[model samples]
Target chain A: MTDTPSQLPAHDEASIRVDLQLVADQIKADSRVLDVGCGDGMLLAHLRDTKHVDGRGLELSMARVSSAVREGLAVIQGDLEADLKHYPADAFDYVILSQTLQATHNPKEVLEGLLRLGTHAVVSFPNFGHWKVRLALLLTGRMPSTPTLPESWYDTENIHLCTIKDFLSLVDELGVTIEAGFALDGNGQKRSYKATGWLANLFSEQALFVLRH
Target chain B: MSVLDTSSDNALAPRLTLEGPLVLQSGVSLSPVTIAYQTYGTLNAEKSNAILVCHALTGDQYVAGAHPVSGRDGWWHHVVGPGKVIDTDRYFVIGTNVLGGCMGSTGPKEINPETERPYGLLFPVITIRDMVQAQARLLDQLGIEKLFCVTGGSMGALQTLEWAHRFPERVTAAVPIAGSYRHSAQNIAFDEVGRQAIMADPEWRQGNYLEEGTVPTRGLAVARMAAHITYLSEPALQRKFGRRLQDRENLTYGFDADFQVESYLRHQGSTFVDRFDANSYLYISRAMDYFDLAEENGGNLADAFKDTPVRFCLISISSDWLFPTSESRAIVHALNANAAKVSFVEVESDKGHDAFLLDEPEFHDTLKGFLDGAARTVGLDDGAQGESA
Candidate 1:
């Protein structure tokens, strides 16, 4: 997600990624949500339209933040690493970090901040351990790059990229309960396989987890 | 022309004097208070689309049309015109000269009825809340029970916040851009310097310059020069002027406007004195310094808006060190603590505090979105949407 140029989709929220839409589906109506690294606020807008959710966003890029705010979403220009600490504990019903976990400076601390700020935390990230990425790395003898993670290694912002297994281990260490999870393939289609275990990490192009303290 | 004219038949700026004396926050009663204002667009049958636009320190009632004194276009014409962000075609817009303003309002420059002379230093010290109180009187006279929105920037933003705090039920929504709940220490210091500059001039004559048959032009110019610097960012200055020479290539050792920056500052100062009153500057700046909403609410910012139903959209400029984004965030935190409906946007701009007045597309978009959203909740007709640039 970090490797892809940050292009805002059309105003139609249906054009948002399938994983983000799935995340939106889990949220109940009228709940307060905080979208970290919310980009142009597609999911927040969608949730506001569908769920009547009171949504707020924290986006690192001012350009994206400006666009989000233009679309009537409550967004502030902020860094996920530094700005998350300012939000009061349990200020939100749900905090969604969609496809932005890999680009954070400290994914664990960011996760801790998310859990602290919201009653439930939804996190999505590209799976670095996918079969295609592994095959490319083994055959090319270099860092793997796939369509989902398209940037050259030197220019990529995915400094802390991880797989489903890596994220599950961190969740276990933090002692949080995973309420729900979803796996998606390379075509941005949700896979019905159990979101955990070895096969999910190797084959799923991306993963989504709903965790609570 | 009498400054306290109670007649409402004036063609240019409409004037109205309140029915009774308005007791000031400083405990001084000001009788026959007058407010000069300009109105644009129709108020509609339901009268629910009224937006009260408060002007900043140096701003006046000219929100959209050309300014009478300066003959230049209104300061916020970019955002307040027919098809602009404020969109006069859709909403009823009213801009007023603040209580302590020099533009056809009862300020230090206005003549005192008791002494038949300019009030000057005799004008009672005012606060942001007091300014809003005067506006409320104006609204009462206009028969407007509730305002759809109240919006402003800089000192105007302070007034916007004051409107929401003092009369929560009267305001449907508010947009405070590049403002703070209280004046920061640095802000007070900068305003103090300007006041001192005005007082230091011999011609000022203890705020009696009007009686002395001479204006404190030099002092007012110097003060304007100092205050104008705070309105811009260092990056904007560097990009616009840098180390470039003015007019001549070689540097003149004799302090004759050697740099383009110096020339620019001088022009800003000189042009300012022609249209503003020095004593009015002192009164307005002092009012701003005394503004502290949190302190007024017993030092708990959240208490200022407890259980208030007003919606808010706060905006700050990224490069505005004078007001800063942190000030806006503090407001957001307080609103959150109170569980008030609020949204905040820190616009990325190199233009600094004055970005609120500049052509920042993002700022306009955010304002349009907030206003449009608020309009929906208030049951106002959307009408024809304005063309976005």
Candidate 2:
């Protein structure tokens, strides 16, 4: 029933999604972190409980924002595209945009804004070049509906979806420093391939990058 | 001015008369300033658990008890009782009647000691800042070095903002619910209509209705009726009244409260007239119109909260066209610009601006969460026992 993990009442490590747990794992304790499109603040709350990070959130949906704030997480009801500029440069130690990059109206602009908002930016997105997605598209000659891209093209909000290689090229074009990159398997647990390699783009279902500018 | 404190929780007499003139933002001063207030819960030993709740435009000092004038449960009784969302059992809660209010405070209703008459039109126009200043002095008299939180809805929210802005060090957290940093043009226009309704009454006698011993019930009722519509949404009105007729089934063919909505508004107006003063309404309405946080900070709302240490939680109702969610969004943007710790929740409610006063579970949950989060940061131990007074 819940999109993100339900971390309220008490922190349950098992309920947290793999990608969100990965994002939480990278953040340091007591550092200011802003999670863009942080739905229900599961990751923020997790960080607050485990790392004791000073966490904040920006979510577009009022429902999600209310859920986050109802848990005492500092969350604002706003889009990262419009609201990110209001936050001063380096306002946060880390700005996380996980599983929401493709859904943003302008991914490039949002990435730039996120980079400007924090000393480091952690981003994760579903890879459109995964073998299952490519095979489905090639065999059916229709938009792929893999596990990551579950919804039909007409129904999905991932308007700016891109592959791992595409994302790396944009990162290069932006001249941002990539602190680290990972290519996760379809389950979002095993990091077997390097995000910079074409093999990773073709095989992995998701990609994560820790960037700085 | 005599400061009378029967120390009892009676709504009529608990008050504090400041020793000096209260300098106001209008470059005028109010002498013999008396603040009618009520307190609930015990002040902790460290005095760090004090919370100041500023009341709305017509709201009095009775925040969590039977109101003397209305004889009804307090406006915020649903939220501020012991073990409730605000938990009066833990925090020392204080609610004060504003400076330009009729509720035992220094206002047009009170006699002017110098003239031996009601201040009426002679009373200097008070601003939201003036109300906050009076509240600050009240805090000083109570020996509270800093407030754990200052919160309110509507006009009270404006006072909360002024407190956070003017005395950031004195406030650890602030929650401004269903409010804006400044009054919008439409809001000011609605307030003007209310004022004009009061003034148009022959019984008003140009703000001297008190001296004439004639209450401007009709005009004040009309004003309340008009303003009351703004507090509820179109859907709420549609759901509550719609085209449903009151008492009779068919139209009466005259403007004698044929519709249920009309009857409701009329009842709201007449009842408000019984409890409120026309001059105080005018004064408080004018004060809200004059409140502009951005204007005071040289056109940048962010400047008003520059480097402010206070954590803020702003709650806006979805259908509140009076103080729309956009207004709260603007304030949130400004707070974000300063990197100030802030939370903004636009609650889904068709109840409109009055939802803050109503029992909305989301609003209560958001408030409780924010306060709990802030209390943790402020080092207020929930487990500790409050000292008995």
Most lDDT-accurate candidate? 2
DockQ for the candidate 1 complex? 0.37
Q: How would you encode candidate 1's per-residue C-alpha lDDT over A1-213 as one tens digit per residue? A: 242323322325446556677788779999999988788787898898889998888777767776776777777666778767656788889999888889888888989989998999998888898999999989999999787888889998889989888898999999999988888777666764463457888988888888998
lDDT of 1 at B179: 98
Interface RMSD of 2: 0.9
Each model's TM-score, in the order given?
0.88, 0.95
The all-Cα superposition gives candidate 2 an RMSD in Å to the true structure of: 3.5
Candidate 2 lDDT: 0.87
Worst 10 residues of 2 chain B by lDDT: B1-10
Using DockQ as the measure, which candidate wins? 2
Q: Could you report the DockQ of all the candidates, in the order they appear?
A: 0.37, 0.80
TM-score of 2: 0.95
